[model samples]
Target: MAYSFPEEVLEHVFSFLRSDRDRNAVSLVCWSWYEIERWCRRRVFIGNCYAVSPEIVIRRFPKVRAVEMKGKPHFADFNLVPEGWGGYVQPWIRAMAASYPSLEEIRLKRMVVTDESLDLIARSFKHFKVLVLSSCEGFTTDGLASIAANCSNDSVARLRFSRTSNNVSTTKLLNLREIDLRESEVEDLSGHWLSHFPHNCTSLVSLNMSCLGSEVNFPALERLVGRCPNLRTLQLNRAVPLEKLPNLLHRAPQLVEFGTGAYSAEIRPDIYSNVAEAFSVCKQLRGLSGFWDVVPAYLPAMYSACAGITSLDLIYAAIQSPDLVKIISLCPHLQCLWVLDYIEDAGLEALAASCKDLQELRVFPSDPFEAEDNVALTEQGLVSVSEGCPKLQSVLYFCRQMSNAALITIARNRPEMVRFRLCIIEPQAPDYLTLEPLDTGFGAIVENCKELRRLSMSGLLTDRVFEYIGKHAKKLEMLSIAFAGDSDMGLHHVLSGCDSLRKLEIRDCPFGDKALLANAAKLETMRSLWMSSCLVSYGACKLLAQKMPRLNVEVIDERGHPNSRPENCPVEKLYIYRTVAGRRVDMPDFIWTMDKNAGSPEVL
Candidate 1:
């Protein structure tokens, strides 16, 4: 017990240690001390400990239960080499497999892993409970069959084979509670996999295969509903359409949560008639997200479906206040709501009057976020929310309109309130050019949001704000501050009090301690630090490397985002976000690109 930290202390400590300086310290502790450390460390990606070999990693601390390896694919300016899949990982994994006997879950993302690697893994992973092979294009059904043959029936519960070329046997996929064969070419994918699920996944739940094409059909899930009486959550990729969703949920009886994302392709107006019809059949539906297109109309049927939901999201469907009021009033159990578009004040007021059970809400106001919204919020929005949801806990993504008076009401009324995720474009404040020193309205955040745990600040935060931030958010674990300048001393206050801080995101903000960063001479507690477009000197990068030697730093060059522009190219910018993960979540763009030249290897 001498060196052993308490479970709570270990949890708190592990949760906040974001930098390599902090992680290495956890790894350095002796075997007995490392056990407690391992519990907290499991939340992070396992393959990231690159500085330590698999053999050494096991020798150092041997109780790893779950391992997730981000399969390294060969990147040549984004043309992934088929042969490069899981090329170097076989040996490293063989080494890792030789050590851990208690491994439970394994997820290989965008796997460059081949048949040979999967063969070795099947033979080796004796205790693997879940196996996810995402984008493992090189694999065939033989490798998948091998995994099924090797894995004990009912032991391997969840299998996600996305974009894989496996010609799987129907009977081989039994005992699975969830099977996501999305974007796959699995020829025999049908109801054969259902016999084992619901029964195999007796305690199992949640199925997500929104983009499985026609390989997996809604009718097939009818067999799944018959077996797994407890199945509650389902996410379909426009396959079942919306109208069929309710019938599917009704068959399961235990179904509750359902959601589908936006549609971009050209379609007729009655495209989501299925969505409206589906809600009608679900007698016990709970969490729901409504979808409607360009034309605005009243959905009386949707209002009826909103009766018992605790969390609701509507796709800008409600044209008038009365329609939404009917929907909110029916949902007496409603707690959380997210709206991508704003409804009029009448709708807000109507919602406040009815949904007394509402607690947390996110509304992207009609007008763009500016200082005026702050005052307007207190009088119009905040008053309505306070009058209705007295037990409100969190309100995120609010603009600069969140004033001191509004902040005071929230603190006084919602005592359990802890987080206030905000983005204020103070530089764009109407009177920002003529503002006096003491006239800035930011001080209210520190004064009222007393127990703030997470703070995301953007748009020219002053030096004084940091002090208030560190003081108010005393239990802060994640702090993200975005700026648009060269040097701003706003970080000093955070450095003073946020000893428990875990993830720090400094965007477009600059500081002078470019050298002290290396003094992070291994700043161990900080794990996920993001510095984007900041006037961060190269010296600071070097310092970060020195301080946290095991850091997987991402230094984004904004200039690289523009290649097609001006006279010849036409478009001014070819943005990474637009073409990458930003435009669509399905395609997560390459976050960090390799700088490998020809004749060199990919993974370093």
Candidate 2:
């Protein structure tokens, strides 16, 4: 006989488990535990929207209230993916609307969301509160207006008022709480969406519209900010002028995170004092960003608010090293920083000396297409940060050159790195000091950093580097390669090893049919594989499609029909993923969907 816990006790235990991995493991314990876990689970995360159907998700987790779904490959942000490629959210929305009526949150990334889908969401979930669309596209302000006007209704307010008759004066009914649209591509159809919120609605806590390309109505925005007493995070687009920022700050002094919109204005004494005075009152501000078209004269106005900032983003601001050094000196508590390479090595050294609590750093190239090595940034900048910031764990550094010696030193200094992505601006760039492949440098990273989960390699590499990665990087989940590798052996080494690998992206490499067919079983365990401008052939793709019944192998040949070329001709691009939804129906004309059961290759 086995001792079993009571159902009540197990339910209590399951409520405390937060991660999806942990919760999934708990469900597989036994029959009773599976039933209890399914009933108690409230949140679900879908890494790839096409991997599983919405009906399957609803059937598995019947009581879920929140969902986070991602669509498109990571390289889609760089324009590698074509427009109208088919990551639509309408089907998922339609399915969930019929099942989960009490759903409160829907978070989507890199997906196409039309206005009709947004309209359906607003009319479907009565208790909807949060909508976060990051790096998504195919929606405009008209869709946003539907969300604002329809999310909270007057009937709910009246019911609340009737419930608390004596305390009606103090009670407020706000149904919606958050709308986060960071880094999303939204069309600015009109600026009147802010005016859609009801006068009594005071539920907004976080609002981010920083990615909008057009101006918004200023008066409506100011009023909305004034009424939302609980608003803590507010991000505005670059169209918001500098002069109007003072009034908004005065209205929302309780803000914990803010993005300064258009920090450029004429140098006037009154305006400068007002700006400084407004920032002096924001004692709770922690995260700051969005200094578009920043003027150096206006930088000092916000110095009083910089002492407590932990996350600072100046990627859009092209300030030189001297100004960057001055701003960094004031931020002693900075933990995460994103800036352009205009800061150079000098500014990073200053950052290393001052900010000891830093955990993450990203340096973007000021001008990626510039042929000359204009900026003074090099591997030395990263080495300095690693030497000074003992708690550093993640880095994304883009520079012109790197060396094996610097990487070895950095690896030794920070053995706790979880994500190390270094992109040399020039493709297939070699180590500047010795002019050799960067095999030893990246090999040192995988060997030393036992916890590395994501890696993007650059600077010349070869089969030797892949061998190092396959052997040592046991926990690596995502690997991005471009313009490197000697032959199919590089891909073979990776597929043979890396048990936990989920996503692999390759471009301009020499990998082809031999390595792919040799390890065909490995594709079943991974989430996705994207190869473009490589040596993979159409025949190998067709065979992979035929052999693996669960995988959907798609060939993107925009030049002409797949049958027009020889079977041995190399395909222009290949995208393979495991999917339970059969084949996507909305594929464009250029896409060639291989069928598993067809005797001959048929384009669907």
- In terms of TM-score, the best-performing candidate is 2
- Whole-model lDDT, model 2: 0.89
TM-score of each: 0.63, 0.96
Q: Count backbone clashes in candidate 2.
A: 0
Off by over 4 Å in 1: 1-64, 67-102, 106-175, 178-204, 210-216, 260-284, 290-299, 302-305, 315-322, 364-379, 398-415, 424-427, 430-441, 484-487, 510-523, 543-604
Query: In model 2, what is the error at residue 121, expressed in angstroms?
Result: 1.2
Q: What tens-digit string does per-residue lDDT give for candidate 2 at 1-604?
A: 0128888888898889999999999888888889989998999999888889998899989999999999999989778887777788999999998999889899999999988998888878877889999998899999999888764534353332445465543222227789999889888897889888877677789999999877888998898899889999999989998999999999999999999889999899888999999999999999999999998998899999989999989998888899999989999999999999999999999999999999999999999999998899989999999999988999999999999999999999999999999999999988899999999999999999999999999979999999999999999999999999999999999998888899999999999999998988999999999999999999899889888989988888789888898989999888899999877777888888788877244545
lDDT of 1 at 303: 57
Please list the residue runs of candidate 2 whose C-alpha ends up more than 4 Å from where it truly belongs after superposition: 1-3, 151-174, 599-604
**Number of the predicted model whose lDDT against the real structure is largest:** 2
Q: Write the per-residue lDDT of candidate 1 for residues 1-604, one digit (tens) a residue.
A: 5266667776676668776457768756766445667655543354322323466556545666556554332121123222331224455567756776555556655544456765666666555555565444455545544554543345543454545666443222223333333333333344233332332334335565543434334454665555556667665544444445445655665668765432222443454464456567676778865343422342543555677688876643333445555666688888887763354456567667777777787765444544354223323465567667876766665444344444455556665656665555354232233333221334455456566566665444466667666566667777766553234445556655666676565545655353235335323555444444444443344334434434433323333322222222211111110001111111222222211122111122
State, as a TM-score between 0 and 1, how close model 2 is to the true structure: 0.96
Count of steric clashes across candidates, in order: 30, 0
Q: After superposition, how far is residue 195 of candidate 2 from its true place, in Å?
A: 0.7
Pairs clashing within candidate 2: none
- Point out the worst 10-residue segment of candidate 2 by lDDT: 165-174
